[model samples]
Target: MIISSAEIDSAVVALAPVMRRTPVVASRVLSEQLSADVWLKCENLQRTGSFKPRGAYLRISRLDDEQRSRGVVAASAGNHAQGVAWSATQLGIASRVYMPVGASIPKISATRSYGAEVILQGETVDEALTAAHAHAEESGAVLIHPFDHPDIVAGQATVGTEIIEQVPDVDAIVVPLGGGGLLAGIAAAAAVHRPDTRVIGVQAAGAAAWPGSLQAGEPTPVGTMDTMADGIAVARPGAVPFAHVSELVDDVVTVSEEAISTALLLMVERAKLVVEPAGAAAVAAVMSGQVDVSGRVCVVLSGGNIDPLLLTHVTTHGLSAAGRYLTVTATISDSPGGLMEFLALLRDLGASVVDVTHSRVAGSLRLGEVQVTVSAETRGPDHQSEVREALAQAGFLRS
Candidate 1:
């Protein structure tokens, strides 16, 4: 089933009333660093805080009268669940979504708020999908797959079509990939309108399935996936998306956990964009230099539906990864002046203390001696090393 530009064009026309024409913004910092024109496709600002609704809404809207009456069901890491639920509500059809047991709290809540019966099941999206399939079979609800359907792909392809229209001179597009709906859709659009425009897929290193699947020339399933970017943690490549991606996508690459966190931090600090880890994956790829890119490159920020707690953790991790945060242990005297002197040392080193813990009874501590653990904020990597070196020289550093 070839998904032609005509189908995508029709999807664009059909979805115009519902979907936002997301913006394309230039990344000054990234352009300066990479020495190329870098742009960001802010799909993170799309309805439901993601690009999922494009596919989900289009897929659900296409169902016949009987299917609509019976309702829709789906499984997602988080974003797609909300998309389907919101779309179902808009169409006045019932909806149910199954999300992984540890899915982001905000995403789950948003899905329910969109009027879906939410069930928390399984440890991964693939496992949740199993339950969704069973529900569709037993309850007769039409299964609205997160990907893996012609209509879904066609819907997502609107993003690509928009990208071409938004950046007529774009040289490359980097996308966050899970089951490949977004990547494949964009690749198809590029193939039709701008064949020479490179389409790259970025995946969380722990959950990447495309590299293996593309090598095999078929949809391939992996045994396990572990990543903080739960939104892109799928175990297998969907067959429908695989066909388009395998044939059309220029490259598929993975980004490390640290790199993803760093990218998320950069987006928050530099771009003022609140994006989930999966949403930052493409930027991670670019920042980590995993994918060779130059010229006018654009990366899609796919979603922004992240739990606040997760955002805190990712930001802290990103700080650590970027060497802007540090934790150090030092043995100080179990005396009043001990903490004051130790803090003074940190102040002199220009490290702003974030937190401090003093322990009197820790492993092998002498009777008069105490242990102090300090977490500090620093300027950058070199400053972190300088702080450590200063502490070590003062004979307070442990190790």
Candidate 2:
């Protein structure tokens, strides 16, 4: 079914009272870095820490009493489940969410807190979806898809409405793509309101389908998924979203794991906003030089429900990418004097030791030799080089 501007506008109007009109934040750092006017659509701060609530609420509110009484069931990796659960609770409807066993703890807990019966099943979203669909059929529960629905596309289009009003004369918009609900909806609205503005979709490099699928003139599943952006890690694009995206989206770009992690860190440290790897993929494309932006650009921060453990790793990875964190292994004499010398060398190079481990029996170290693996905080990449040089001068072999 085709999604029109009127339907999208009505959805926005319907959701106005329930969903937040999240902030459009200007980032000087990102603007200077990208050499373009940069404003972030911070939907990461939306009601369910995601823009999913807009579509979920709009979809749920439209259900008739009979359908609502039957309740709703959905499958999700995390964010969509929370969106559906929260929207159902707001509508006073019974809801059950099927999520992958590997879903983040924060998302699982949050969905349960929203008053939805949570069911953990399978290892991946596709598996959970299979189980959810079967359960829905058996229990007569309404199945609410995470994406690929007309109401959902219409609901997601509201984001474009807000963006046009919030950032007039926007030259381009970059959205992270999964099943393409958000991209399709935004593209449709942008085509109507800002036809000249370029709309680009960003996907995880490991899970990208837009480029190949558009070329093939049909949905084509990726061979494998490898990136950290689980939210956009769809093997294949949705039929409904793909139809709109093929026409309205200008370009589709892919970003790497490193770029996504860096973007997430930048959101937290530089922009003071928390964004998940999936939500930060658009920014990742820009930061990784995968996309060119010469004019005013808006990057949508789609969600912010990253696992705490993953957040720690992303922070370290990002810092390492920016040359702010350094890890090195040095082999020295097994004697206690070797550690003293290594510490002195690091201090001389102005490296602050964050973590250090010494092993004498793990490998082929000589009877008097030791392996010291050290993680240090450095001023920059130059300081890291200085530390390496100092260690070498102190008779420590780089491992």
Candidate 3:
């Protein structure tokens, strides 16, 4: 099933009224940092808070009357669940979504809000897929795969069409790869409209399966999948989308967990955009210097369906990774005003104390000494170093 430009055009027409024509905006900060013309395709702002609906809606729309009557079942980590649920509701079809037990709370609630029966099963998407398949078999419902289908790929190809229309001279397009539907779709469309535009795919390093699978010329599954970018934590690439990716995608790359977290923070702090970890993979690749961004590059911010709790963690991790947050343990006098003096030193050094813990009965503490653990916020690495130096010079021994 070759996905052609015409098919993508039809998808665009089909989804025009439903899907948001997400904007393409220039990233001044990224452009200056990478020395490239950086543009962001903000599908993070898309309906259902991700680009999944483009494919989900189109796939469901193509279903025959009998299939629609029987309804549809799907498995996803989060975004796809909401997409399927929302699309199914719009089409007046009953939908059941099997989500990983560890799926984000917000996503689970959002899926149910869309009027789908949400079942929490398994720890990963693959496990949930097993349960979804069983449900489809038992209930005689049509299974709507998150990826792995020609229709899904064709629907996702509409994103590529929009990119070309928005940035005609685009030199490259970077997309986050899960089961490869988005990458395959964009690559295929680029082949027709902008053949010279390089199509790059990014994946979380912990759960990346594409590099190994591409090497073996087959869908190879990773032994263990773990990453904050749950949206792209697929252990294996979809067979159908992999075929398209193998032929059309120019390159595939992986970013570290740290990079993913830092990228999410950068998007929020710098771009003022709330993006999920998986949705920040393209930007992460660029920020980590894993990809060549020397030309007119467009990074797809795929989704914005992150839980608040995860966002807080990512923000803290990002700050620590950037050297703006510091933690240190030191010995101070157990006498009253001893702690005050130490805090005064930190204040004089221009560091804001975030947390403090003191213990006088620790094994390492002397009779008149106390162990103090301080968590402080600094301006950056240089400021953190200054604070550490001040402590050392003030006769405060770091433990």
> For candidate 2, what is the TM-score?
0.97
* Per-model lDDT: 0.92, 0.89, 0.93
Q: Pick the candidate with the highest lDDT.
A: 3
State the displacement of the C-alpha of residue 223, model 2, in Å, after optimal TM-score superposition: 2.6
Residue-by-residue lDDT tens digits, candidate 2, 61-93: 999999999999999999999999999999999
Tens-digit lDDT string for candidate 1 (131-161):
9999999999999999899999999999999
**Which scores higher on lDDT, 2 or 3?**
3
* Residues 1-399 of candidate 3: C-alpha lDDT, one tens digit per residue: 568777888888999999899999999999999999999999999989999999999999999999999999999988999999999999999999999998999999999999899999998999999999999999999999999998899889989999999999999999999999999999989999999999999999999999999999989998998899999999899998999998889999999988988888889999999999999999999999999998899999999999999999998988888888899999998898999999999998989999999887889777899999999999999998888988998888653
lDDT of 1: 0.92
Arrange candidates by TM-score, descending.
Answer: 1, 3, 2
Candidate 3 has its poorest 10 consecutive residues by lDDT at 1-10
Best by TM-score: 1
TM-score pick, better of 1 and 2: 1
Clashes of 1: 0
